[model samples]
Target: MAQLLKRTHMCGVLRAENAGEKVVLNGWIAKQRDKGGIIFADLRDKTGIVQLTFDEGVPEDVFSLAQTLRGEYVIGAAGTVRERSAKNPDLPTGDIEILVEKLVIYSKAETPPIYIKDDDNVDDNLRLKYRYLDLRKLKMQRNLSFRHRIAKVTRDYFDQNGFTEVETPMLVRSTPEGARDYLVPSRVNRGQFYALPQSPQLFKQLLMVGGTDRYIQIVKCFRDEDLRADRQPEFTQIDMEMSFVDVDDVLAIQEGYLATLFREVMGVEIQLPLPRLTWDEAMERYGSDKPDTRFGFELKCLNQIPCVKDTEFMVFRNALDNGGDVRGICIDGGSKAFSRKDIDKLTEQTKAYGAKGVIWIRKEEDGYKSSVNKFFAPEQLAEITEVFDAQAGDLILIVADKPKVVFDSLGFLRRHIAGLLGLLDNKQFNLLWVVDFPMFEMDDEDGTMKAMHHPFTHPKEEDIPMLDTDPLSVKADAYDIVLNGVELGGGSIRIHDSELQAKMFDILGISKEESQKKFGFLLEAFRYGTPPHGGIAYGLDRMVMLLAGESSIREVMAFPKNQNAQCMVSDAPNAVDTAQLAELGIGLCDE
Candidate 1:
């Protein structure tokens, strides 16, 4: 028979004010300490922990049973709240203790593999395998609580702004959205499959077509892409869309929502009207579309530097002649911090990003020391030093390569150097909107134009003509919200005209038949007077991760798949019965 004990208050709810009042508490024993005459135990619930005391005044049997209480044992206690002999300044309910007169041990637990405290420092794999036990840690509890609060705030803010919460189908048709799809074979429809949505993108757009003026969905999304610290195979997105809106309108609503969210959740006031930068400007200044504005080591074009014209150095001259760029960043006080060996290590790191080599110059008291000093005369070095305004302790690092390689190599190097110097402050968040992204990019592998965001993104009105003549030069009316160097979310005004949508498909080399076969529903819906609509999807997992100050999204998620996309706790991605595969008309391929 199950023992039932009525509960009046949570373990952590008792305070000094509740002294002398009878109370019943139910929770797990966090720890137990027996001192011959009395037993003291820490009782913990989801809220927090409170100490329970069983003194000599209590019945002998109850006192003896309290001594046997071990960590994580579920118990119920009827007691009187009283002032503690020694107050624990660290805990919220530390000023009071419970004098237990009755106790019931509901369930006994074996010792947990991981400790039920913050800062356990257990291996990630072991913690994940015993996730339920791991989640009992205070840090994990706080992280999940923060995530819930954010979601609630998001809902309230959006709902108050007249957005309807709508659900889109999970088992959706697979359309190429850059990432590979996680496909599910349908047993009823033999040989046919359904793919989980990477985002509720098309559905949200269709909602605008279906006359839903404002829509929002906090939904799960799936992808088959490689994982990273901030990424997972399956994640959540706070997706939204609005009809009859321009770029400015969408930005205004999002900015307002963010301001409210930060203020309410973190109690930090976010300055309204966040800064904006064009994609070209961001790349030119920071060598990255998602620029980390927290520190300043902005890239400088060496060709624009006064000394490059007079230099006889073949590295810079050959790069310009071969249609490549010569770019460098001046690291403040880098000369004293980095030795020649450190510079050599940096040169090797650049090679990983496709740069052939890195040129380093150090400004010293006597003269400048450089890898290319032999190629340039004293006057040229002097002019170069003046160009960079190099001080005695400064170091200049340069890369000469094709534009893509130069930007990729130097941009990453800039961040790496900042990390080494401890210049990035995680406590500070710098947010900006990167707008006016290029409509298309030329794929290096196939030499074909691909949509930078998606084919549905509408090009700038004035750049529409360029689509026919110089498609690569056309800019989309797109925007991305970036925070501390990471892209938080992105969206663009979508193509509402059927003809323009078809034209976009044509530019991507999708034939009429193929377009009709794959995106026929969207095209057909567009024919029925689609409204001008656009929306953005924020990675909920990533957002929570940033808010909780966690390096990985897995920390915020309850049961996330590991780097290999395997669920450690459930041991998923396991083999199914032969009958199940046969039912679906599927056979294993013998490789």
Candidate 2:
């Protein structure tokens, strides 16, 4: 073996200015090319990649070793940085190349199952199955680096803001936070299980009660739920809680952090305070609380339009007669865009959101065309179009159903159409706070009221009186930070008063006994002196996805599970040994 080179500089740090300087670089070979007279290779590290040169002037042993270099071979090289004869304009260190004096092959790699290049068009499963190789790509390395910077920024900002970085228990008593809990069985205590913390919600609040006025933690949380592009069974949260604060106080703190983050990470300066949208207004205008404001096509209510209201069209009639709402959006210059087949596809998409069908009115050069043309005369259709403020070369899509269905269907339709039209720009960050959410939502299956956030969330002071009388009309003192149509984070003033907390449980149909059994500890803690505190938690994975210009959170994660929540690399959720299961007093059901 040759004498090893003591590392001096990173591959990406050497450029034309560092010419003639002795340097040592350690990295995996990105690619290697051998000309008859010389051998050139691109060496890559987390920072970036740089080119290395080996010609006949180099030692015979060094030249022979360089010739054997293959992709992903980890090697160390001692060389002098020199100006490159042919420069690559795209690379940061393109102006210079390394003239290898000595080389050591640290490790050799086999042919990777997947290509390491970012533009490699391969199936996602193959990429995930070989994640170690996949993460070697420059794109993946940059994303992970971006995530790290965000975490550092979060800690620094919070520390400067008087927040104490606190650690919370990962294992805790099972308490529902909307999703099913990922439970762990006890070996010591048979039949008892500890659930993973879905978020540091309760523990952070407890810290506030314990006189930790401000707390912050970048913590891991877990949930036993179905997965999607932006979700994982186990994920990290920028968890936080603060004492002596209202909704505005928490929002202000988050805004400061976000402003600092965006300016530093994305080089985008955010205006001091982001916009705020009331929940009711957002639903009515955009059909979504986390509405994307980058594009037009705001939803409009068609219930009051005379042609739509009094038309006697069976669909419209049933919706209005039953006190349901009818809402729509007009897409400019989309008249001929959606053909009958396209409209049918739109209907199929809306059906998943509980909408029976979609009604569209397209004003073409000739005349008005619609799905409801038979039910209404030509003039009436024109009147309906006029109400929607739609002109020729315009389209009006309407959903007539219950208010929930209308909002869900139309909200999704707007974003879907925007995507097709190339309007939702990932680089354009549109952030706002969605406030004044309803205190509770009705669960149709059992006709019961469930907390929109959690039972511990406090109701607005004025709305507290109405909670007993009209729970549906009451509002929670909660706020959600929305970015680009996604709920980035949310928090609320907690019900610190034990009496109020008990009342909340009662209203949610939890019997006093059931409440004591499930959330007895939280209720017990509330008995002590508790401060007025609120906090917010950001989905760190989702935040990185937005800033990294990636569509899926998997791109930003180091190791991510598939849609079925299975880790392809580790193969988790596999059967446990019978002895281990027996120790926990568990049994597996036969398939």
Candidate 3:
């Protein structure tokens, strides 16, 4: 029988200082080699890996037991620490190895479905199903450790900054608006449902009212929305709310947090008060509100080009006449890069996003070459090319449609095309505050205007008067932090006055009674003298993914659900028993 032992040192903790001292180590066997007379085993734990060697001369029984060890078999070794005969320069514990005089095989493990190594070849579903084993891999373990460090640093920073970490409710009354809610039927209160929070928006505001002053919670929020590579049904948000704060105050506090966070998490000091770009400026330059500013392929407006009216290109003329837009970006040395087939496929993708088509102008060795150039004579082509400052080997891709479609298509294309050309440098950290978003956006279906951020976001003071007139022209105090074309988080100074809140609801097409029904308590609280409040919530998982240099948020998560929102490991979202369903007075309608 194997002897029980107490561990004096971790497998990865031995060094030259303890060379003459005896120690005990415990870990799983990462690898084992048998050369008949002598056996060697590399033991691995979460900390790192260490090697153990057993020779017949040291102990015949220990050598005999070491020979029985296999990969992933749990074991304990008690021996005198010694210098390694063959030093492994690559390993952390390379200079030292344990010379085993005592060996204990604790438990044996079967072959794992997935290899406990980085770059293991296993299907994602299978890996998730055996996430415990998958997490045992060095890469996954490192990701988790990095995530924990970031989280700890963030919490500590906030705590130092006079913010209180509070826990909010997971089950609350369903007050639906933004995304579909995940409802849980309450057995105690029949037919009534409790919805998982899409966010702690309302509760955070209430906390401000309750005088929490500065509140932060690393909380789990749920949204029943379509999943993407970066999205999961249940995800964590580093939520925060502050009372008696204006836009500047909120930004200042956040900038301090970010400076500390970046220094702690990435070892890179981010300069405080990062650059800010107005929503219009960002969209006009990169065709995206969340523009990746690491590379330059800025959008150039051709709406003022004189030939646009007389070009005879119907797409261009119709768009110009219909109060739409014509914009394009000059790709550096792209003339020879994209062929006709490639441009056609780009046009197809733009069309899917509602753009009519894409037009291209190439500056060749001689002159301008374009499919639409037939409509423009030499003089006109020359004038248009001159406006764009065309150069040899340069390609100009243009889109003409409604302003929205034009921006959306070219914006997505700029990033996509830049990625294809390897123009974006991921090593650079680019942070921009996109502010001055329009207060309301027109719904294409009914032309009804709705708040761009949310109804509670306070409109800019000057634009507040325009709420009764051109609401669409009004801008809000909202700002989003964009990093590499991803909106990391967003928040706004809220409308705390009850009258303003009611006015916002009116503009959003929610009636007085309707507002009361959905947000009656909040409206009532606002009447009791609420302070100026604002807050932001960051996608903590995505933030950790960036810190870990990971491609997907799933890599940073321990046991994330798949794209379909089902947990392969836990088998969550599974069907309940028929008797339980009957108790809830519900049954599937389908046959």
Error of 2 at 410 (Å): 0.6
Which parts of model 3 have CA positions greater than 4 angstroms off? 1-4, 8-22
Each model's TM-score, in the order given?
0.96, 0.97, 0.96
Cα lDDT computed for each candidate against the true fold: 0.90, 0.90, 0.87
Which residue pairs in candidate 2 have backbone atoms (N, alpha carbon, C) closer than 3 angstroms, thus clashing?
Answer: none
User: Which pairs clash in model 1?
Assistant: none
Candidate 1 Cα outliers beyond 4 Å, as residue runs: 12-21
RMSD of 1: 1.8
For residues 1-591, could you state the per-residue lDDT of candidate 3 as single tens digits? 777788888776677777878988888899999988888899988778888888766767777778789889988888888898889998888988888888889899898777887877788889889998888787888899998987898899899989999999999878865789999988888788899999999999999999999999999999999988788888999999999988898889888888888888788888778999999999999998899998877888888888875666789889988999999988888898899899998889888789878988888888889978778776776666776687899888989999999999999888989889997777778888999999889888898988888888999998888989888899999999988888888999988988778788888899998888888888888878798999999999888887677878899999999888889998998888999988987778876
Error of 3 at 246 (Å): 0.8
Can you give the lDDT of residue 293 in candidate 1? 93
lDDT by residue for model 1 (212-316), tens: 999998999999999899989999999999999999999999999999988999888889899999999998888899999999888888786656754557777
Q: Candidate 2: where are CA atoms >4 Å away?
A: 1-3, 365-367
RMSD of candidates 1 onward, in order: 1.8, 1.5, 1.9
Query: Across residues 303-359, which tens digit of lDDT does each residue of candidate 2 receive?
Result: 887888787888999999998988889998877677788878988999999999999
